[model samples]
Target chain A: MKQFTVHTGTGVPLRRGNVDTDQIIPVRFLTHSSRTGHADALFADWRDDPSFVLNRPEHRGATILVAGTEFGTGSSREYAVWALQDYGFRCVIAPRFGDIFRENALMNGLLALVLPAAVVERLWDLVEDDPRVPITVDLERLRVRCAGVDEPFSLDEEIRARLLSGLDPVMETLGHHEEISDYERRRRPTLPTTTALLDGPLPA
Target chain B: MGSTLAQKIWEAHRVRRGGADDDLIYIDLHLIHEVNSPQAFAGLQARGLTVRRPDLTIATEDHNTPTIAVDRLIQDPAARRQTELLRENCARHGIPLFRLGDPRQGIVHVIGPELGLTRPGMTIVCCDSHTTTQGAFGSLALGIGTSQVEHVLATQTLVMRRMKDMSVTVTGELAEGVTAKDLVLALIAQIGTAGGQGHVVEYRGPAIRALSMESRMTLCNMTIEAGSRAGIVAPDDTTFAYMKDRPHMPQGAAWDGEVAYWRTLRSDDDATFDRETVIDGSRLTPYVSWGTNPGQSVPIEGSVPSPADFADPQERAAAEEALTYMDLKPGTPMRDISVDTVFLGSCTNSRIEDLRAAAEVLDGRRIADGVHMIIVPGSAEVRRQAVAEELDRVFTAAGADFRAAAGCSMCAALNEDRLRPGQRAASTSNRNFEGRQGKGSRTHLVSPAVAAATAVAGRLTAPSDL
Candidate 1:
């Protein structure tokens, strides 16, 4: 996995609460076996409309996605995170995020930042007014800062660790292969000797 | 500090805490499927490692298998390769498998409970998201990745951070025509899909207690929609009774001892949760999704909301986008939305009970002229039971297409069966994600009763409309 600091890019101000994984990357795209190439698949249907933020050229290379509350709601598909990352989004600022999506995103090195609703609204308005405005998401400090915001918001500690380390449950398990092997060997029972069975047979 | 059910389960299974952000917890059961297993097995092969606990792991094919002719599966070369790879992988590792032709073969979630493999207080992991459906049996079931699948096969454990607790209490009796599907849909709409995120939800109260095993499964199956790791219903007499005499259930004295343990699974009277939501079942009506997402739903009697009416600008934008994709006019009665197709089967609502509910509605009537209706059972056993009761005949007589059993047929379009582009379908599936059924296919999540009624009316309709 590649590691890079999150910096705000050109912004697209989307004011939609309860944006779900289905809307992020529809189920039709899920059938593909390859995990890559989902950037184009992000909001495929919605991007067709000229009014969508991503479709507008002014929001190009936006690494920060400013949105309403409860972003990334619905299915636990990690592809949604992949799509967002591939689409040049490094961090998502919302009032709240769906639990599984947040986990999946952070585990895969995507930053999902949750801030107060008022702060999110302010960021959305700033971006909507001028799509050229940029925000900076400092991974080291775990803070998201924009021009209009009074104070940078801190991300959850758990999410910060996941994003910085790129550690997933599977990678964590794989890291301890030796310890697990030792435990399995020590706990396993030995088979009885053939001599012991022969002695019992002779007695019988 | 207060602990959520996820935290409790995670802590209980902890083997060790590795560095910051690395908490290793033991896993009890590892369920495998065709789509995600091949690569994991290849990883194991490259490492020159073997499956450590063959007995604790199980494999089955669900995603790519066709519903028709059991013997003709090799027709699709790509699907054939996936199935062949799974067989080869399991064989090389000495792991047991339930292949397509096997009587035990079915949707992984369905087979787990039916075979008594899903038990109380056990941690279950699979590569499929809906694996949370197994939580209905009181297990800490959730989805994992292929690398995690290999890890569980090799180590029998996983690592994770803890979660918060959430209690959803449903008091009062459900009115007639309200089902578990309706309850879950209503819950998703009220809480807005992300409500239960980072929380382990425990369903409680009089209404939950009144639900049958099938109904309970339906309720738990959609927990993923709420972004929860799992949804659990405490094991009660009803739970024990449901498991009694099953082929793999404990017998006699063992059964008694198990029941004693299960009795302690419920929350104590003084137990508290981080979050609590109460719903009066009496007020809930038959529910359906009006937009692309499960949370964008309303009661059958309600009309689509005008985007301008939304207080939140974001919400208004979402409504506008949803209306555009759904080809629905804002402020119109949701009941007026016409449907060209009706599908009544999925892990969410494809049990025998669900089939019977639809069959009862379609028994003496024919499907509307332009409506194309289909019924796909959840599993082979369900299909066998339906056939025994002649439910298939009922569906066929009503102009419905009755297909063989397959995973995510119309519910997910993982197989050959799918809606054509721009077509609208009323589905009993859990999610209504845009094109969830096919490219440009529109889905409206509904109860089995509503799906049946819609088939007859060629439009979105409630069971009462039948």
Candidate 2:
């Protein structure tokens, strides 16, 4: 995980809503087990079209992605986040995001900011007008400096804290291993366990 | 106030309360497939952690595995590589895996319920969003990402924020020819794609209760399209009856006790939800998507709507974009639009019941000339069962290419089976997203019955239209 505070970058406006994970990185490209080298596959299909937003000359190397509502609206493929980051996007600004995609973004240290639709529209206008318009996403202040507007957005405190410190959630959950074991022991016997169905624990 | 089905299950699985809204919840079942889980396994090795509950975890080679050529070899090198990694990871972790040659191999969601592993009052997690399919059994099933997948593999628990509850109750009865697929499509259209975001939606009411277990699974499977992480149905006689003779069901007293506990997994009448929606089941018709997102749909009898008809600016823009990409003209009757292909597979509607529905429509009639139809079952067992019932004969006789292999075939376009560029399809899959079937491929999501009917007519239509 990469710790983050404030970052300034140009923006690329992806002018479509419900931009799904399948599009961000099509399922066809997801063959190997490895996660790296996905930058070339970002928007694999749309990138070929001359009129597509990302293919435009000016938006290349842009680190901020201003997308429509319901941006990453489908699939739980974390590869989509990797694809965005692989394309050098450190932050994604959308009105809303798919629940799983949003979590993936934050866990990987890519800032996912949810601004009002109106605010997003204004930023899109600014970015479309000038692709070099520097947008500042301040994780510490919980505000975005874009389109000459400083607007506050809300994020869960723990997620913000984790991002600032570059903490891994797995380590945090491991800290409560005792509680997890106790819960497992106290779980109702009726609940189906693989061991119950398979007749003893599987050997690792 | 009494707790809803989701609340009771969440409470049962709560490992510990954190200072934040997030709580650690124990996962009773963890499912993995080839596509989204490889990275998680690699992460586990890097972190020097072993799987804490290999006994509770399961894996299947589904998504990346091609749905053609079973015994010979995996034709695609990339898919073969991915499947090989899954086998290695599962073998190292000691997790049970159902391989391509195994009869049990299938889409993770389809086989979970088929093998009777999915039970009421359980918490299930998978890296795939459609894991909600198991929620039809009253479990609190959710989709997690790779990071969470690795965390669960290592610790068997997830630190997560609680989801708000939303109830989407269906009153009245499903009219003749109206299937769960149609009802769900109508639901998404009514509530938009983001309707169920941040909430666990419970599908209840007399209409839902009347649906078969398979149909209930179909309904719950598409919950992700409505932006919900999970969708659940209360356990009832329908659920129990479906579980009765399955391989994993407990015997004698254990079964009775499990049934008794399952019966109690329903929301109290007085319990309130953060959001509520009601659908008149009688009004639902065969629905299909005309846009890139699942929410952008219309009834089969309706025409493609104009973007100008949208009240929201974003929605209007989306409709415009969809119409351009889909190559659909406003005011053009949906039935009048023709398609070149018909895909009858995906976790959403690839169950035995879906195959039967399509078979029934294709029983004595051949698909239209030049209209290619491919029928892939949800699992090898499903395909075997369909063959026993001679549904495969019906499909093949009707000029459809009925496949013996079972996995996600044309749904995500991960395999060799896909629509050619500029080709349109009436598919029973959950998504109609841009380039889902293939690059420059246009998709119209339909029910199995409607898909069959469309194949017959070479256009989008209902079964009764024939």
Q: Each candidate's DockQ score against the native complex?
A: 0.20, 0.55
Candidate 2, residue B172: lDDT: 97
List of clashing residue pairs for candidate 2: none
| lDDT at B254, model 1 | 74
Best by TM-score: 2
Predicted complex 2: CAPRI docking category? medium
Off by over 4 Å in 1: A4-15, A47-52, A59-62, A125-134, A148-151, A155-204, B1-8, B17-23, B36-52, B72-88, B145-154
What TM-score should be assigned to candidate 1?
Answer: 0.87
lDDT of each residue in A14-101, candidate 1, tens digit only:
7777777767987656554444688988988788889887888888778788877878876556678878988888778788987667
Give the i-RMS of model 1 in Å: 9.5
Candidate 2 lDDT tens digits, B208-304: 9999989999899999899997999999998999888877577899889888888888999888899999999988888988988889888999999
Kindly report which residue stretches of model 2 are placed more than 4 angstroms away from their true locations once superposed: A195-204
How close to the true structure is residue A9 of candidate 1, measured as C-alpha lDDT? 69
Compare the candidates by DockQ and give the number of the best one. 2
Candidate 1 local lDDT, residue B23: 68
